[model samples]
Target: MKAAIIGAGPAGLAAAEVLSEAGVAVTVLDRMPSPARKLLMAGRGGLNLTHTEPLDLFLSRYGAARARLEPAVRAFPPEAIRTWCGGLGQETFAGSSGRVFPRAMKAAPLLRAWLARLGERKVTLLSRHAWAGWDAAGGLLFNRPDPEPLVLRPDATLLALGGASWPRLGSDGGWAPLLAARGVALAPFAPANSGILIPWSAHLRDRFAGTPLKRIALSFGGRTVRGEAVITAAGLEGGAVYALSAAIRDAVAAEGEAVVTLDLRPDMTADEVARRVAAPRRGQSLSNHLRRHLALPPAVIGLLREGEAPPETAIKGLKLRVTGVAGLERAISSAGGIRLEELDEHYAFRRLPGVFAAGEMLDWEAPTGGHLLTACFATGRAAARGMLRAMVG
Candidate 1:
């Protein structure tokens, strides 16, 4: 059977691999000039293929969609990802943070190897083909630049168009309107792993923009995440900020703003901080005392000055008033998409049979590190299995 996989991101590529292995003729189509642009970008920062955390904790990271995505993830868990990477001759290693990466620490090698494997399987990759939804006759139509549009009818189709983030890279969320018109239920897209826009003063913004706050703990809505965050000109961005993004994003949506508490010295206890602050000034200025005793940098001290003077314990709970989340353009991933209920157990659309979806295009969001990539691979494989079952059975 002939299968068409759209978007060519992690999800679509994973699905293509599965379908091709099942003796199906797979053609992976993408709008861009090449495939897996985002994946290449992700590899720049060391491609986090998956996490080495325990299964239960790893599954819990998907939040409410855990139950919906669990089956696929379980069927092809983190171990499977490492095995698959090994199959591609990419040795996998877990960092101290439990994030798995290829020994090469780059995406190019893995991607090149993967493409070679796909090529060996005769899985066709047709780039620069922009999907323009279905034609009047229910045939798939694509917008080719040469003015002559192309149309085809495959036995099955998988739309893994990704989410609204990194639109310039290909996943522009342009497919949402098309799918919605087909009576598919959709959740409005929102920034998932994105920064929060805090209205910092001109001085801080000018001086501290791009400053990295290391060994910090951020808390919001009773959840605490410890990691590093960078002070962007727009606001806060990085792993810690991303971990709190969902909570802060929801609060901002519901209440117009959200307050997050940042612990500059997360390794120290509240009492320890209080003791350090209570030490004699010894003719030192407040800034000097903070720097000397607490070892806080000038940027962190600037943040402290933004708030009212409080007890030493309060220093550990410095509040940041977040205005809104960064837009999808700046987001690493996106939350919300085709709602889970709209799809069946096989990741096939209930309203549109013979069609399947996977990856960030679905209504699930997870923190960065490796969860996102893991789920993408899992769902993509699952969607292909679904398609194969439908075709065979």
Candidate 2:
């Protein structure tokens, strides 16, 4: 059987591996000149493949989509991902944060090994082939630099076009219109794991922009995440801010703005902070006092003084108003795609049989630290298995 997988990303390539191993002739197409551009970009800062957290806690990261994605994740979990990486001759290690990364800490090596393996399996990879809906004859259409679009009719197809984030890296949500025209149900795409926009004072914006706020805790909507965030000219971005981004985004949508409380010294209690700040200043400036007594950095001190809260309250919980979230172009990933209800248990579209989808194109969102990548790999494998079953039956 011949299978065509669109989007040469983590999901599409993963599905190609599964189908080719099952003796299916798989052809993977991508709009970009090369495959896995986003993956390589993610590798710039240690490629996090998966998380080693307990299964229940890890699954809870998906939030509303947990039930829908649990099966695939359970079948092929983090351990499996590590094993697959090892098979490619890339040993894996878990960081202190429980995030897994290849020993080389770069995606290029893993991807190179993976592509070589796929090539050995006879999987055909066609680059610069952008999917352009379908023809009246029910054949897939792809646009190229040439005048005429390329058309193909594979026995089965998997659409793994990623979500509408990092468009420059190839996932531009261009496929949304194509699927919607076919009467497929879709959810509006929104930014996920994105930075929050805060109206920083001119002083902070000019002086502290690009400063890193390390060892901090951010709390919003009853959720607290301990990590580090970097101060941008417009607002904050980093793992800590990203963890609470979804909740903050939803709150901003419901309300005019969302308030995130930042704990500058997360290791200390409210009383401890109050006691430290109450220490005799001895004519030292407040900033110097904070620096000397509380060990707070200049950025944190600036943030604390930005709000109207008292020193004690500010140290324990300084509230910042989040005006909005970064757009898809700046987001690490995207939320909302083909809603899960449109697909059956097999990941195949109920209305468009033989055409399956997996990856960020699905209506689910998760934080950073490997949940996103792990789900992409899991769903791709699951969708491939479903396609194989459909072909047999």
Compared with the true structure, the alpha-carbon lDDT of candidate 1 equals 0.92
Superposed Cα deviation of residue 288, candidate 1 (Å)? 1.5
Error of 2 at 38 (Å): 0.8
Error of 2 at 100 (Å): 0.4
The numbered model that scores best in TM-score is 2
Q: Write the per-residue lDDT of candidate 1 for residues 1-393, one digit (tens) a residue.
A: 999999889999999999999999999989999999999999999999999999999999999999999999999999999999999999999999999999999999999999998999999999999999999988889997779898979999999989999899998899998998999999999999999999998888999998999899999999899999999898899999998898899999999999899888989988899889989999998889889999888888877865555534557898888999999998999988999999999999998978999999999999998999999999999999999999988
Error of 2 at 240 (Å): 1.0
Question: What is the TM-score of candidate 2?
Answer: 0.98
Give lDDT per model, in order: 0.92, 0.93
Angstrom error at residue 328, model 1: 0.4
CA lDDT of 86 in candidate 2? Answer: 97
Q: Write the per-residue lDDT of candidate 2 for residues 296-328, one digit (tens) a residue.
A: 888888898777786546888898889999999
